[model samples]
Target: MRKNSIKNIRINSEVQKELSNIIRTEVKDPRIHPMTSVVAVEVAPDLKSCKAYISVLGNEKAAEDTLEGLKNAVGYIRRALARSVNLRNTPEITFILDQSIEYGVHMTRLIDDVVGKEEVSDDGMNTEGDEGSC
Candidate 1:
């Protein structure tokens, strides 16, 4: 089969949805934060394993706890996915913390800071009114 075939894409999406729901409603671990979200999922072509990207809205400790909770509940999640999706072999779910959103925010803040400094310097250097006087 070709890489990332239609069938594989559909399977990945279904698994992502099912796993998100399972994590939200079924898992009762206290370590799992309520603000956790499934960012993305990538299923192998062979359908034997999957990587689930998760985003947690909190500090590093909270992210660690959330990941630990998901790791502990992997079995239950896989079972639920198997039942919800029609597949011969349920892919093994591996939860990975996604920090791209946080990184983007940081980058934006840095850009804004630079722009603010530039604007302040420009304001100080404005001699337009006295340009033709001298």
Candidate 2:
């Protein structure tokens, strides 16, 4: 199957959803943060391996711990995936720490700071102009 085929896309989304459910409801590792989420999943065309992008809404230490926790539970996770998703081959899931969400939040904060400063400077300039006009 082609990588971007409709079938592959469907499988990817199904796997992503199932993985999220498994992690959220099944896994009981304390190291895994409660704010952890499966952001994305990529199932290879061969269905032999998969990449699960995980996002943790916490500090770096928390993200590391979550990754470690997921790694340790790979076997159980795979079995769950197989049970939940009737795929020909239950892909070996590789949990990858995805920082895209954190990066986006950081960028949003920076943009907001810049915008706030600009607004303040604009107000100051407007006040100065009004005084000069008076």
Query: For candidate 1, what's the RMSD?
Result: 2.0
Error of 2 at 109 (Å): 0.5
The Cα local distance difference test for each model comes to 0.89, 0.97
Candidate 1, 31: how far from true, in Å? 0.4
Query: Cα lDDT for residue 82, model 1?
Result: 87
In the range 2-98, model 1's lDDT, one tens digit per residue, is: 4489988887788888888988998899999999899899998888889999999899999999999999989988888888889988888899999
lDDT over C-alpha atoms for residue 77 of model 2: 97
lDDT, residue 95, model 2: 95
Per residue, candidate 2 scores C-alpha lDDT tens digits across 1-134 of: 99999999999999999999999999999999999999999999999999999999999999999999999999999999999999999999999999999999999999999999999999999999999999
TM-score of each: 0.88, 0.98
Considering every candidate listed, which one attains the maximal TM-score?
2
In model 1, the worst 10-residue window by lDDT is 124-133
CA lDDT for candidate 2? 0.97
